[model samples]
Target: MKIRKANQNDLDEILNLFTDTISEVNNRDYSPSQIKAWSSSSKDTDRWLLKIREQYFLVTEEEDCITGFASITNEGYLDTMFVHKNHQRKGIAKTLITALIDYAKENQLKEIITDGSITARPFFEKHGFKVIKKQMVNRKGIEIANYKMKKLL
Candidate 1:
């Protein structure tokens, strides 16, 4: 797999990956209703555009297809990290996260933060992120519980 900077052209594929992975892989941890509410298609186009345009988004590609992606805001916030369902447990997410952290370090960012889902909290914890708080985020009127985690760079 190769990691590279994401362009606007990658937005559609990234959004699809995000939706698919969340609905599939994240189902192991979240309920169906929570998944549907969290990854609702109604928010895709606009949010995808914003993430692609404003954040430092990176994609992992293999055989010309994007298999995973991570996006970090300029202020060192880890906005999103998702890997394709079929591509899970192969270190793809770790690689993408390592690249994002490296970018943060290079840019002199002081800290990195993410609102991590149950499926992702362990990964962030393994990477040295400490839980700051447990948060119940309302998505489409459904309360989704997640951890607010942070790592000092």
Candidate 2:
């Protein structure tokens, strides 16, 4: 797999991966309605465009297809991380996250924070992130459980 910076042209693939991962992988932890509410963010084209244009967004590609993607802000906020549902446990997330962490370190960031879903919390914990709190975030009037996790760099 190769990791590279994301471009606007990657938007459709990234959004599809984001929605698919949440719908299939996260469904184990979230109810169907919650999944619908959460995955609905795929329609937020402007937000996705902003991240692709302004943040340190990266995508993992293999055989000309995007397998995973992630983004981090200058302030060390991990904005997004999604591996294709079919490509889970294939080190896609690890590679994407490692690149983001390296970017943070290179820029002298003090820490990285993210809202990790129940399905993703373990992975975050495995990477040395600690749960700051468990919070219920409302999406389309549906409350979804996630952890506010942070790792000091």
Candidate 3:
């Protein structure tokens, strides 16, 4: 797999991967309604374009197919991280987070933070993020559980 910084041209593919990955991987932890609502953001062209241009967004590809993508703001806010449904647990997420962590450290950011899904919380914890709080957020009228986690660099 190959990982690189994302550009505007990668937006549509990134959104596709985002929707597919979340719908497949997050189903066990999040209800179908929640997943639908969560993945629905993939259609927000403006948001994706802004993030791709303004944030340190990266995508991992295999044979020209996007398999995973992650994005982080300059302020060390880890906005999104997702691996393809068929490619989970093969170090895709680790590679993505490692890249983001290195980027944050290089930029002298004090910490990296994210609101992690139940399925993703363990991964963040393993990467040295501590759960600052457990949150119940409503998405499209569905209450979902997640953890607000942070790692101090």
Candidate 1 Cα deviation (angstroms), residue 148: 0.2
Best-matching candidate per TM-score? 2
Find the candidate with the highest lDDT and give its number: 2
Q: Model 1, which residues run further than 4 Å from truth?
A: none
lDDT of 1 by residue, 23-120 (tens): 88889889999999999853658778878889999999999999999999989999889999899999998998899999999999999999999999
The window of 10 residues in a row where model 1 has the poorest summed lDDT is 41-50
For model 2, residues 1-153, the per-residue Cα lDDT tens digits are 999999999999999999999988999999999999999989999999999999999999999899999999999999999999889999999998899999999999999999999999999999999999999999999999999999999
Candidates 1 and 2: which is better by lDDT?
Answer: 2
Candidate 1, clashing residue pairs? none
Q: Least lDDT summed over 10 consecutive residues: which range in candidate 2?
A: 15-24
Question: Clashes in each model (backbone N, CA, C under 3 Å)?
Answer: 0, 0, 0
Residue 112 CA error for candidate 3 (Å)? 0.5
Q: In angstroms, how far off is 34's CA in candidate 1? A: 0.5
For model 3, the local distance difference test gives: 0.91
CA lDDT of each candidate?
0.91, 0.95, 0.91
Task: Output the TM-score of candidate 3.
Answer: 0.96
TM-scores of the models, in the order given: 0.95, 0.99, 0.96
